[model samples]
Target: MSTARVWAPRPATVAVQIDGVRHPMTPGEGGWWEGPDLPPGARYGFLLDDDPTPRPDPRGRRLPDGVHGLSQAALPRLAPLDWPGRELRDGVIYELHVGTFTPEGTLDAAVARLGHLVDLGIDFVELLPVNAFNGTHNWGYDGVAWFAVHEAYGGPDAYAGFVAACHARGLGVIQDVVYNHLGPSGNYLPLYGPYLRDQAANTWGQEVELSHAEVRRYILDNARMWFEEYGVDGLRLDAVHALRDTSDEHILRTLSRETDDLSRRLERPLTLIAESDLNDPVMFRPRHEGGHGLTAQWSDDYHHAAHVALTGETAGYYADFEPLTALGRVATRGFFHAGTWSTFRERTHGVPLDDDVEAWRLVTCLQNHDQIGNRAAGDRLSASLSPRRQAIGAVLAVLTPSTPMLFMGEEWGASTPWQFFTSHPEPDLGRATAEGRFAEFEKMGWNRDVVPDPQDPATFQRSKLAWDELAHEPHRRLLAQYRDLIALRSREPDLRSPRLGDLSAEIDEHERHVTFVRGRIRIRLNLGDATWRPEGEEEALFATSDDVSGNPLMLPPDSALVSRTIE
Candidate 1:
C-alpha cells in the first residue's frame, strides 16, 4: 500500500479509482490532493468531482495500457551492473534509435547488438528518447509522459537491462530527454494544473511552465530519476533553447549544478549534455563566469559548414553557410557564426568563444540523427556521396579536437533510408502529419507525390539497418577505415581535449581546399573539381585515395588525408 497524490486545483473533489472502486482523496495544500495507502501496481485513475471520465496520473511511472489508459507503478527487475564509472571525456558516443537499430525494434533486441558497438570501439551509446509518446513509433521529440518508458520498447525493466548490458561491456549510456514541450495528444498536465503557460507554443504546440516552481521541479526530478535512480551515466537535454524560463536563475544553470553535485556525491562520473541552438560559448562555461556550466552542448554550425562542403547543398539553413570559410574558423575559434550576420536567420546570432574554453566540451558531427533522419528523403551520408567522400568527412570528424559522435550504421554505410515516420492513433493527426511532411519537402522542390507518408509503417521499416551489408566489399573496407580512424583518435595524444589554442586552419577558397592543423598533425582535404598535390611537409598517416602514397600528394577530387610529423 502507498499514498496516491495528484495536483488537481480545477476540481472540487478528487478520488482514486482502483480495481473498479472509487476511493475518496482529501484535499491538500497548493492545489494538491492525496489518498491514504493504495496498491502500487494496480491500474489506477483519478475521478474528478462530477466528471465521470478517469484521468491518468501526471507523474506516472508506468503505462501498461498505452498513454490514454490507466497508470500503474511499474516494478522493474534490474540485472546487476558493473559500471566502470567512465567520464564523458573518455568516450566516443554513438547515437542510436532503438526502434530502427535492429529488426526486432526493442531495447532487449538492441542489447544483442551491443557487442557490435563494443567491437566497433564506442564507449558511450546515446539513445533517442524512450518516453511514452502518443504513437508506437516516433522520432521521440514529441514525448508526453516524462517518466514512463515506451511500452513497445520492452517497458522499464528492459530499458534497465539494456543499460546493464551496456555497463557490463564498459559502455556508458546517455539518453535524450525532451523537457521543452510535450506532444499534442495524450497530454494530461493542463487538466491537473497550470503546467503550460498562457503563451503560444514554441514549436511542438506546448508551452512548458518553466518559471513555476512545481513545474520546474517536475523536470528536475525527472533528470534525477534517470541519472541517480536508473543508473544512467548522462542525459542529453533535448532543445534547451525552447525551455522558456524568466526566473532569476536559469533552469539550465541550476540543472548543471545539480548534476555536478551528484557526480561528486555518488563518486562516479555523471554528465549533463545539452542541445542548444543558441551557439553560445556560455553553455559549458563555469557559473563564476556568469554562464551555465553544463558538461557540453552540441553546435550545428559545424554540421552546417561541413554538410554544405561535402554535399554542396545550399537549401534552407545551408544558405548562409560558406563551407570552406566556416570550417576554417570553426577549426580554431570553435564557432564560425559566433556573433556574425546570417542570411538564413536574417539577423546576427551566436556568442563569441572565450579563450579559456576547451574544444572537447562542444559536440560536432558530420552525420547525426537530425542530419540524416530529418531530411526529406532521409538519406544517409553514404547514399548521398561516394565512398571516398564519406571517408574524407570521417577524417575531419574524428580528427577534430571536439567530442565526435557517430550515427549508427554510418561506418559501413548501411543501405537504409531513415525517412520520417509515425504511428498516430488519431485519424485527424495522422492525416495532418502526412500532409505536413509532404508540404515541407514540396517547397524545397521535392515532388509532393513522391514523399513517403509519415503515418505508414513501411517508412519506419525501411529505416532499419541491414547488418548483412558488413560482409560486402566496400562495406567491409569502410568499416576498416572507421576502425583505424577510431584507433587513431584513441592512440594520438593530439586528437583529444583542450587543444583549442593549439589548433589552426589554412584554406584556399578558390581551389576549394582546406587544411586543419592540431599540434603536429594536419588533416588536408581537396574539395576542388580537379586533382591537386597537397602543400607542406609531413608524413601521411591516413589517406582516402590509394594513389596518395609518396610525397607531392596528388589527391583526386573530394579526397582528404591526415598527416603528422615523424616521431
Candidate 2:
C-alpha cells in the first residue's frame, strides 16, 4: 500500500490534498502525519493548521511544475562503480555547475559534454550539488532532498547514467554534497528527529545536529549512498566547519571510517574532500592519529593571498591579505594565517601544517564559486584583469604547491558571470530573500539596489557557460597554456612533490614582479607596467602575454614568463 507522510512538528492540525480531495492525516508520535493506500504519482500537498494555504511536501522527490504540486517518485537504476585508476593528486580537476555547463542544463546533456572535458585533459569533473532544491534554478547549496537527484536535472537515473558515462570515458566524478545545513524551504528532517539544533548556529543558519546519534547516522548513510549507490568516486563535503558536533568521536571521523569500509568492500579508492575554512591539519590526519582523517580540504589561504596580491583590491575579507608576503607564506608554509593574527577576525587563526605534508592534501584555486559569485556582481578575474593577467593567475593557480581546481570556463576565460540565484515558489520567501540580500550588503556599505534579486529568472540565465567563447584567440591561447601547464605538472617530479619548503617565491612587491622556483624550473611574473630582467640566465618556456621568442627577457605589465634554470 502506498503511504503519504508530512512533517509538521509545531502544527496541531495537518491535512493532505490528494487528487483535489482533502483528507485529515493521523499525526504520529514523531510529528509525522501518515495516510496509507496513496497511489503512485500522487498529486498531494500539505495543509498546515487552519490556514487555507497548502504547503508542498518537504521531502518531495519530484516537483514537476514547481513547489506546491504533484510529487513524482522515480526509482533509478543503481550500478557498481569501479575506481581503480589514477589518484586524485595525479590529475587535473574541472569544477562545473550542471545547470550552467551547457544549454540543455541536464545530466544527460552534461554526459554529452564529457568528451570536451576529456579532450581538455581533465582527470575529474566535480559537479556542484545536483540534489533537489526549491524551484527550477538555484546554486544547489540549498538542497533539501539529499537522496534524490533534482527532477529538473533528469532525476536520479540520469545522474547514475552520467556517472557511468564518465567512468566509461576514464573520467572520475566527484559530487559536491551539503551536510552542514538544509535549505530554508522544503526542509523536513527536523520533524523526524533532532537533525537540526536551535543551540548551535552557522553562517547560514541553525547547524545540523551531528552530535545526535540518529542525525549522524542519517548523514553518514547519505554519504555512503552517493559513493556506493550513485557510483561517484569522491565527495566534496560543503562547509564542513559549519557542521556542529561536540561528540568525542566526531561525525566527520565516523564518516571517514565508514567511507574507508565502503572503499574496501567495493575494492576501489574513494576520497572525501572537505570545504573547510578551518585550516586544521587534523582534517587530513589519520583517524588512528587522533584526527578527522579526511583526504583533502579546500585551502582558502592560498586563494585569498593569490587573489588579493594579483588584483590589489582589499575589501571585506581581502583586507587581511594586502601584503604579497601572505601569498609567499602560503606557497611555502601551506597556511598564511598559521596561528598568526588575522586583521579580519581579530583572532589568531589556523595551526601551521607540517612542511612534509603532500600538496594534494589541500586544493587551491584563484577563482571558484564563492570567490567570483559572492562579489558585487559575480565579476570573474577575466572581467577585471586583461587576458594576459588572467592567464598569469591560471599559471600560478595550477603550478603552485597545492592541488589545483579550475572553475567552469576558467581555462577559456569565458566572460559570463556565476551569480547567486534562486527561484523560491513562496512569495514570502522571495520577498524575504530580496530584503535580506539588500540588508546584507547595506551593512557592508554596498548599495542595496545593486544586489541582483536571487528570485529573478534572468539571474540563472546569465550564469550559464558560453561555449562559443572558447573558439576565440585569447581564450583558446589561455586554454592551450593551461593544458600545457597541467601537462608539465603531471610529468615533472618536482612540481608534484608536496614538500612546502621545496617551494620558494622571489618577489619584488614594489615592482609588482614575482618569481616562483620549483627545483630547476622558474616561473617569472611581471605585474608591473614596464619590462624587467630576471636574476639569472633564463629561456622562455611559456609566455602568457607578449611573445618573448626572439626578444630578450624584458617582462611586460601583467605578463608571465616560465623558464628552466641552466644546470
Q: What's the CA error at residue 251 for candidate 2, in Å? A: 0.6
For each candidate in turn, the TM-score is 0.96, 0.89
lDDT of 2 by residue, 400-464 (tens): 78888899988888899988888898899988987887788789888867778778888889999
- Predicted candidate 1 versus true structure: per-residue lDDT over 489-556, tens digit per residue: 88888778865777788999999988887778777888898887765556878887686642665678
Predictions in order: lDDT: 0.83, 0.80
RMSD from true fold, candidate 2: 3.7
**So what's the TM-score on candidate 1?**
0.96
What lDDT, from 0 to 1, does candidate 2 have?
0.80
Residue 285 C-alpha lDDT in model 1: 85
Q: Where does candidate 1 stray beyond 4 Å?
A: 75-84, 535-537, 550-554
